[model samples]
Target: MTAIKPGLKLKSAVCSAEVMVIKAPAGASLTCGGAPMIGAKDDAPAGAALDPQAAGGCQVGKRYVNAEQSLEVLCTKAGEGSLAADGTALELKEAKKLPSSD
Candidate 1:
């Protein structure tokens, strides 16, 4: 688990996915490709591969949020891995509906 904060950049250990933290709760564990994400400046371990079960693929420019919506991250780069928090897969945050000007 990492102490995440807004503006912190992270990269996947097993894929090319990268993200910036927008909002994160304390003690949240961010994962990509079923492996814990590492700091953007850190080097990934040797022989790391994408997890077949978590290969949902990440989309660039998308916002992913946890079930409680407390943890959110913006995808800075796309890759063949999905985002997850605390073992639960994060979902794409839907755009807010605007009121009609009738």
Candidate 2:
């Protein structure tokens, strides 16, 4: 079953992420910090599930969406929580800028 999902991109320069497919219960949702996501369906895209607190806390879910396994998440940048080609996060204060050759 496929559905149109509207969500934010996850990535930055200093921090990075991986997409994976997890084995979780039917209706579980994966959360990083507090944001929720599903398995990235598009080729260049990006989900979630699994109880990190449980004893067998290996990172997997119905569609974990991480670098360890999934491919859709490749669309987002590594950090700063924005799309790879987006301008808002690319202009971060700590981000380095190349000097103009002129």
Candidate 3:
């Protein structure tokens, strides 16, 4: 068995305001938002609006669209993991032994 190490780390990287979300499954009849974007998933049927109290707020996999207005979306960290970034998995490092101080 092998233990995996951490990789590259980029702190709060400020990206410009051109934020984009690409939906999948493109077609000609639909409103084409230009190339590079595949478009919305028509295969994925229109989802049901969720109740906040029932769902305990929005989840990841469970599909739901925001139907409510003036909802205070308090963006909080659900959990945290080892902060890693793009790059090689770091060179396989060998553990070094220290000399006896005695």
Candidate 4:
């Protein structure tokens, strides 16, 4: 778990995925590929591998949010791992429907 704020960059410990925090609650536990995420400047452990169950992969340029919608992150680089918070998988945030102009 880490104290994350908007604009903080995090990288996956097991994969190449990277994200920028858009919104995050204090003490939020963020993970990628079933492993805790590290600061962008931090180094990953040697021989780290992706977890099979969390290998759904993340898409570049997509925003993923938690169930309560309190946490959100933007994928800056796509990778073979999925994003999660507190052991729950984060889902892609759907685009808001625009009002039809009459």
User: Please, what is the TM-score per model?
Assistant: 0.91, 0.25, 0.15, 0.90
Candidate 3 deviant stretches above 4 angstroms: 1-80
lDDT of each residue in 1-102, candidate 4, tens digit only: 458999999999998999999999988889999999999999898877899999999999999999999999999999899999989999999988799989
- Tell me the lDDT of model 3 at 43: 27
Of the candidates numbered 1 and 2, which has the greater TM-score value?
A: 1
Residue 51 shift from truth in candidate 3, angstroms: 25
Instruction: Write one digit per residue (lDDT tens) for candidate 1, span 1-102.
Output: 458999999999999999999999888989999999999999998888899999999999999999899999999999898999989999999988799989
* lDDT of all predictions: 0.94, 0.27, 0.18, 0.94
Q: What TM-score does candidate 1 get on C-alpha atoms?
A: 0.91
RMSD of each: 3.1, 14.6, 19.7, 2.9
- Regarding TM-score, does 1 or 4 come out ahead? 1
User: For residues 1-102, what per-residue lDDT tens digits would candidate 3 score against the true structure?
Assistant: 011112211111111001111121122111111111111221212342222222232221222111221111111111111111121111112236689889
* Winner of 1 and 2 under lDDT: 1
Could you give candidate 2's per-residue lDDT for residues 2-81 as a string of tens digits?
Answer: 22223433322222333332222233333332233333442322232222332121121112232322222223322222
TM-score of 2: 0.25
